[model samples]
Target chain A: MSFVDMLLRAEARHRSRLCVGLDPDPARLPGRWRGRVEHLYDFCAAIVDATADLVCAYKPQIAYFAAHGAEAQLERLMAHIRVVAPEVPIILDAKRGDIGSTAEQYAKEAFERYGADAVTLSPFMGFDSVEPYLRYPGKGVFLLCRTSNPGGDDLQAQRLADVPGQPRLYEHIAALAQGPWNRHGQMGLVVGATYPQEIERVRAIAPTVPLLIPGVGAQGGDAATTVRAGWRGDAAGHTTGPVIVNSSRAILYASTGDDFATAARAEAERTRAALWV
Target chain B: MSFVDMLLRAEARHRSRLCVGLDPDPARLPGRWRGRVEHLYDFCAAIVDATADLVCAYKPQIAYFAAHGAEAQLERLMAHIRVVAPEVPIILDAKRGDIGSTAEQYAKEAFERYGADAVTLSPFMGFDSVEPYLRYPGKGVFLLCRTSNPGGDDLQAQRLADVPGQPRLYEHIAALAQGPWNRHGQMGLVVGATYPQEIERVRAIAPTVPLLIPGVGAQGGDAATTVRAGWRGDAAGHTTGPVIVNSSRAILYASTGDDFATAARAEAERTRAALWV
Candidate 1:
């Protein structure tokens, strides 16, 4: 099945738009796993099992695993997710961007090595950098647009003078993802949940593509505002536009004790409830 | 020692500006190593040993290693470089960009886990994304400004209206890298050699920051034009501004025989000579 089809199906089956980010920071691991990089798979597996039915997707940030040389564990985690939450798609939040050949390697790493259903990318290198990822038949790629950080304004909010009436860098990315660059209908835009206004604008430009909205829980974005701005569906509950709102720390470390997995599930349940529109 | 000082020292010691890129693509490996992922380290280590005294720096594109799930081999390769070429700095060509916290993980992956002397990054996420890496005192960071890819024109060439004189996006990055972002004097800009005119423009805007220029051999960038545009030095051969011209495939796959490493050394010597003023 296509990535979008899997996402929509998972969303409908679970009645959730929440995507739990599996960022296994060793320093924050609980109990015996605290500061133990070896348990990256163990810690993340428990959380996945607990929230198996509460999320439409699971996002594994590659940097977190790579920081501790835990990619083997990440591979194991990907397999574990496939077994425990088979319908839930995994998006590798790698944010990779490169020229054609290098981009192909990253695309392969995301799809073949880790079996990610989708991947996140930095759109800085432009269309050719994004082109290789689109070659994969059923995979989806999300381009970073209008990020939540204050410093994001330094570049993302700059106006492009030569483009007709002038659009901000992020809007240009949104338009590209919505139009020409998204040839296969497999492209998505990542507009942070912290920027609801920008999310609305991105939704206006690219109404139907999946928007991977981060910054909701620990990053302090309103869950309702994000769904209201990006989610579009029919009265019969058919989602034409999808919003995958991601919350990492708030759910992962709801309690930093031995009941971490249970606490994570409770938070995921609460987050899912909050995001249900 | 600071990464810049280390680079300058290496450049003077070697009398070369060539930055050999240790990108080991399995299918392209020579002789018995053909299509073998296990020999990633061996292939790269051989090249590094052959060219250690002929180049100022070594860049290992992370995607090439990660694609094969050979990151552990890359770790061993990094260690091998330190043992074989202690003075030559290593640049981990990651192009990583994210929000603050996530950026921390990537920074850790590059600096702590991989022990890279420097790391390449995508400046799309703005200052906060670039800020975390700056915290590592002696290390250096290179931000992608004007890339070699044709798709780079899509974003980097766009005229930013809000900035005075409608400077292009890459020019804006050049100004930032040369100005406030160089707080610790540890920042550099990556301006591709394929666009020599753009390289000159970046040089004129930034003036003193190191320019990591890729796309020389296989990508068809002119070595002489690249040097003329970015390299600056005094009569005594003391470089105030440095240009690290990188070549990967041309040297790595110079021959497909058992004498691959010797051919690689010959190519590296020729490349270093071509870049020499």
Candidate 2:
């Protein structure tokens, strides 16, 4: 099945559009799971176990695991997720971009080595940098469009003279995504929920492409505004678009105390409930 | 010492401006060393030992190691480089980019876990995405600008209306690198050697900043044009600018026979000599 089809099916099965980010920051882990890289795995496993039935997908940011030299642990976590929550997809938030041949290796890293269903990519090098990842038929690739960070305005918001009416670079990227660059039907855009206006603009530009909306929780994005702007409905007024809202630190470190797993599930439940509006 | 200072010192000591990329592809490995990830380490170790003295730096593309689930072997190769040739620097060619907090973890991954002297970064998300990597005082970060791929023209060549004369996006990035983004004197740009004209423009925009010029060998980048357009000279005609030309497959798999290491050394010597004039 295509990534979008699988995503829609998972969303329907879980009755949620939430993607819990498994960014296992060692410092923010609970007291019981505080020390080694092994603790990192335990923390992620506990979060996955607690929130598996509530979320549509799990997003693992590769840097957190890579910082601790824990590729094997990450692999184990992916395996654990596969066994425990087989229906939920895994999106490796690696944000990897490179030339053609090196990109093929990264495609192998995300898909073959780590066994992720999708991966994030940076489109700075343009088409070829992202083309290799599209070769995998069922996997998805999310291109960073308008990020939630404060410095995102530095470049992504710049006006392009070559574009008609001098549209902003991010909008230009959205148009490209709607046009030739997305031939495989597996391409998506990452427009942060922090900027609802940009989300609306991106949604208008690329109406049907999936948008991995981060910044909904710890990054201070309003759930109402994000859902109102990004959540497209069918003609029957049902929320049918692929807007996977992600909550990373808010859900991962809901309570640093002993009841962290329960707190994470509660937080995930709350976020999922809010998205229903 | 800063990255530029160390790089220039290495260039003066070795009298070479070549950077050999350690992208270990299993299919290209010699017949005897084609089995496990340990063989990957041995293959890279042999290449580094053979050509470390002939080049200014070694760039190990992270995807190749990550593809084979061999981060430990990559770490071992880096440690070996530190012990074998202490003067040469290692640029972990991980084109990583993300928001600020995630960028910090990637910074740790490159500087702390991998022990690389420098790293490659994608500047698509702008200032903050590249900020965390700048925290390490002595390390280097090369921002992508006009990559050597055919798809580079897709986005980097777009004209920005905000700039004075609507210069191309890559030139705008060059200007930014020469200006505010490079406060610590450790920043550089990756302008492909394949496009010598773009190299000339980038060289003019950021005269003193280092340029990591890839695509010199198997990518079909002309050595003569690369040196002529990239190499800067002082009033006395002494070569002064930092233009580290890179060749990966051509040097690494110079001969797939029994004398692969010897052939690699010869190829590195040839490329290094070509960068002089």
Candidate 3:
């Protein structure tokens, strides 16, 4: 199935658009699940198990696993998620981009090796770096449009001259994603919830493309504003758009104490409830 | 020492500006070393051993190793490079980018775990994605600029209105790297050799910043044009500028027969000799 259809199905089943980011920092893991690589796996598995039913997808950031030299643990975590929550998608947040054959290898790594339903990519190298990921028709590729960092304005916010009316660089990217890049209908844009205005701009530009809105929970982005700006409504005025609001640290490290898993579930549930409002 | 200093030192010592890319495709491996993970290690080690003395650096593309689930092989290969050719730097061509914490993990992966002297980064997510890698002042960060691929034109070639004369997006990126973003002075740009004009343009934009010029051998980029456009000379007219010309398949799979390593060394030598002109 296409990512959008699968996402809609997951959204319908869970009645939520929450994407729990599986970023397991060793220092922030629960007391019992700290230090070791096995514990990392256990911690992420626990998070997935605790909140699988409440989320549309689980985003496992490749960096946390890579930092510990525990790719095996990541493999295990993804496997566990597949077994426990077969319906919920796995969006591997790699943010990888390269030219030609190297890009193809990354695609294989994310889709074939890691079994990600979707993989995040950087569009700096333009279409060549992204085209390899698009070869996988069943998979989804989220191109970074407007990120949730202060340094994001360093380049993404630059105004483009070639574009009519001189739209910003991110707007140009959104147009590309909505146009030629969406031939397979598997493309999405990552517009940060922290930048509601940019989110609103991107939403208007790429109307139908799914928006992976990060920075909602721990990053201090207001969930209500994110929903207001990012949430697209159907013709009948129902807010049924494919907008995934991700909360990593706020949900994962809800209580670094012993009640981490329960707290995570509670936070995820509360966040989902808040999104509805 | 910083990456530029180290790179220059290596270049002067080796008397070459060639960067041999160790992108090992399993199907393209020599007949004797076709399958198995150990063979991949052996293949890369042989390539390194054969061409180590003739090159300034070795760029190991992460995708090839990640595809086979053989990151251990990559680690071994990097370790082998250290043992055999300690003077030559290792450029881990990961092209990784992400927001904040995630970028930190990738930085760790490239610098600490892989022990790369430098890493290639995609600037799509802007400065935050590239900043983590820059924190290590001793290491080098080469931002992707005008890529050699046809699809690169889709975005990088778009003219930006932010600059005085409305320079292209790549030019804006070049200016950024040459200015504020390169505070530690460890920044560089990856401008493809296939587009000599773009390489020349980037060279002019960022005069002193090192350029990792790829697409030389296998990608049909001319070496003479690459050297002419990419090679920047000091005011004293010495070719001491940091411009690395990379050749992957042409040097790697030179024979694809029993004499693979020997052929690889010969091709590296030939490519190195060509760069001098």
Candidate 4:
């Protein structure tokens, strides 16, 4: 299925816009899940078991696993996630962007190796860096737009006179990404929830383009505000089409207690409930 | 010593401004050094031995090695390069950029694991992404600016209103990077040879910053024009500083013949000789 159609189906089935971000930070992992890949697997499996019904997708940031040389182990973990939550989509969040040939290799790794439904991309290497990944029939490529970091404005706010009007670098990226480069309707923008105004601005321009909204909970971005900024005026208020709300630490690190999976599920439930408001 | 001081010292010692790029494509390797990690080691060692005397630094683009699942083999290759060309700096041309924590891990891998003198970074992650790599005293961080790709103008050409008087994205990056972020003087920018005007504009603002100019021989960028562009407008129109000229495929693939090292050295010599024009 196309990313849009899959997203629509998943949202309808789950009845939620929430997408849990599985940024498995080793340092922050619960005590029971520490020092063992098996434990990590169990923790992730339990979380998936508890929250799959509440979320449309799961995002696993690759860096956290690769830090521990857990590439092969994480492959196993993802397999377990698939078995546990067979219906939910997996977004392998590796913000990779490189020259042409190398990008093809990365595409193979993300889609063929991990079997992810979508992959995040860093557009710094230009469209050629992303084109190979977009070649996959139904896979989604979420390009980095206005990020949540305080220093984001450092380069992102820079204006180019060559384009005549429309300042901010992020706006420029949004403008170009909406067109010929991303024709499949599978392309998405990562608009941080912390920057509601910019989210609204990006949403205005790239109306059909799905926005992967991160920074919702642990980053102090209110979920309700983010949904409004993202879904409001989103292409004639066809509210369901173009936004997937993401929460990482807030859900994953809900408790250091052994009932961590239960805590994670509650956080996911609360986050999912916020979508209706 | 600081990276700037190292560059100055290299310029004085070598009496040349050349930095050779080591991008070993398997298809381009000579018959003798065709496959396996051992072949890569021998090939890289030969290049280092042949050209170390005439160059300021040697850059090994990590992608070429990394594509072969040779991530572990990089240490061995770096060892070979260092043994052959100890004094000449080694810049691992991995354009890595991520969040602060992830950047720290990449820094560890580049500095601690591979022992590269410098590493390239993508500025998309903001200054925080560059900080971890810059924290080390003697290491260099080359930020991507004005890339050599054709589709580079898409988002890089966006104009932002907040910065007042919209500058092309690269110019704005150069302006911000010039001042507060000039930690240890280890910062350099990757200005492609194709954009001479942008190069001049960036150079005027960041006069002290060293530049790693790629796209010379193989990528159709002329060395003579680049050298002339590197000349700071002093009273004598002389630049004591060196602009690291990079030639990857042109040097590495000088010949598919058995005496590839000899041909490679000849190419390096011819490339260096062109700077005088």
For candidate 3, the docking band is: medium
Q: What value does DockQ give for candidate 2?
A: 0.88
**Regions of candidate 1 where Cα sits further than 4 Å from its true position:** A233-240, B234-240
For candidate 3 chain A, the 10 contiguous residues with the lowest summed lDDT are: A232-241
| Global lDDT scores for all candidate models | 0.92, 0.88, 0.87, 0.77
TM-score of each: 0.98, 0.97, 0.97, 0.88
DockQ, 0 to 1 scale, candidate 3: 0.76
Error of 3 at B217 (Å): 0.8
lDDT of 3 by residue, B207-232 (tens): 87889999898898999889889776
| Candidate 1 lDDT, A75-118, residue by residue in tens | 99999999999999999999998987899999999999999999
- On a 0 to 100 scale, what is the lDDT of residue B16 in model 4? 64
Write one digit per residue (lDDT tens) for candidate 4, span B1-277. Answer: 6666666676667766778887766666788566554566567768878887778788887766644555555678788776776667788887877776667767877887778888888888688878888889888888887777776666554544556665667766676667787787788888888867777777887777788898899889888888777556468776534588888888888888788889989998888888644
TM-score of candidate 1 restricted to chain B?
0.97
Model 1 Cα displacement at B17 (Å)?
A: 0.4
Name the docking class for model 2: high
Sorted into a CAPRI-style docking class, model 1 comes out as high
Candidate 4 lDDT score at position B176: 60
For residue A42, model 3's alpha carbon misses the true position, in angstroms, by 0.6
